[model samples]
Target chain A: MQVNKSDLLRRLKKIEGQVRGVQKMIEEDRYCMDILVQLAAIKSATHNIGLAILEGHTKRCVSNAIRSGDGEQAINEMMEVLRSFVK
Target chain B: MQVNKSDLLRRLKKIEGQVRGVQKMIEEDRYCMDILVQLAAIKSATHNIGLAILEGHTKRCVSNAIRSGDGEQAINEMMEVLRSFVK
Candidate 1:
């Protein structure tokens, strides 16, 4: 399934807000632990988005390739992406 | 700066081969140091792809948002992705 650009944009907007909030907290001298906690939450959210995108790619592009007898190619591509993603 | 899906797929395929090679190495009881080095290379490649995507997003989507007066939202979304990405 193709990802909706608008939907992605919307989610990104929310994330941007969260980032700014963190910056504000830092500027206000918020507790270090609190800032770290917020940072952790943001990291989780980001990873979730990555997983979602990866899932979508697997379901749509990769699966299609496999069905078309390009499974090896598809799997390879995914590995490449995963390599970078985990870094 | 839209990413070409085909290009992405091609790169992924290469990465897949590398991963399989790594697996094979492990199965063959290849030197641990050799395997670890390959693993590190894979990780770096993966992160590079992510950065490429992120740069594209920033240049295309995020920048567009800013130009269109949705800067706040765009930045937020990017931050969200970054949070997870670093984790």
Candidate 2:
């Protein structure tokens, strides 16, 4: 499964807007809790995006490697991605 | 700064082993809390990996883009990565 680059871009643009909004909120001295809420939303959005990419990668790259009798390599790649993701 | 693919691969190999260990723990009927603790460790490890990549990307890709007067593009790329990450 190929990653939908354009769709991902669109989502990212929106997220960027949200980030900027948060920045603005901070500049304007928004309540701490309110800012935290937005921050949480941004975090959740980011995590969702990660999950999507992970899903796609698993379906396409990892699955192909396994099918090709290179399961170790695929798992290695996945682990690499996950490592980066968690960091 | 280019990403250190070899180093990343090595780290990932370790994480892969951890994941497999977790699986084995499950199969062996390990305590749920113990398994969860391992899971948490894995999650933290994964997040650390992500942080490293993000740091590298920011110091290299994003900073370069800004220095070259392509800040918008860099930010957009960052947002895309963030989107994927949060999901």
In candidate 1, stretches whose alpha carbon ends up further than 4 angstroms from where it belongs are A1-87, B1-3
lDDT of 1 by residue, B1-87 (tens): 125767777788888999999999999999999999999988877777776676556545754565456756665676568556656
Q: In candidate 2 chain A, where is summed lDDT lowest over 10 consecutive residues?
A: A58-67
True contacts kept of each: 0.00, 0.00
Query: Any runs in candidate 2 off by more than 4 Å, and if so which?
Result: A1-3, B1-87
lDDT of 2 by residue, B1-87 (tens): 235877777788888998999999999999999989988988877776776676566545654555565756665666577556644
- Judge candidate 1 at residue A68 and give its lDDT: 61
Give the CAPRI class of candidate 1. Answer: incorrect
Query: Can you write out model 2's per-residue Cα lDDT over A1-87, one digit (the tens) per residue?
Result: 235988788888988999999999999999989999998988878877776676566555654554455756665666677666655
lDDT on C-alpha atoms for all candidate structures: 0.72, 0.71
Model 1 chain B poorest 10 in a row by lDDT:
B58-67
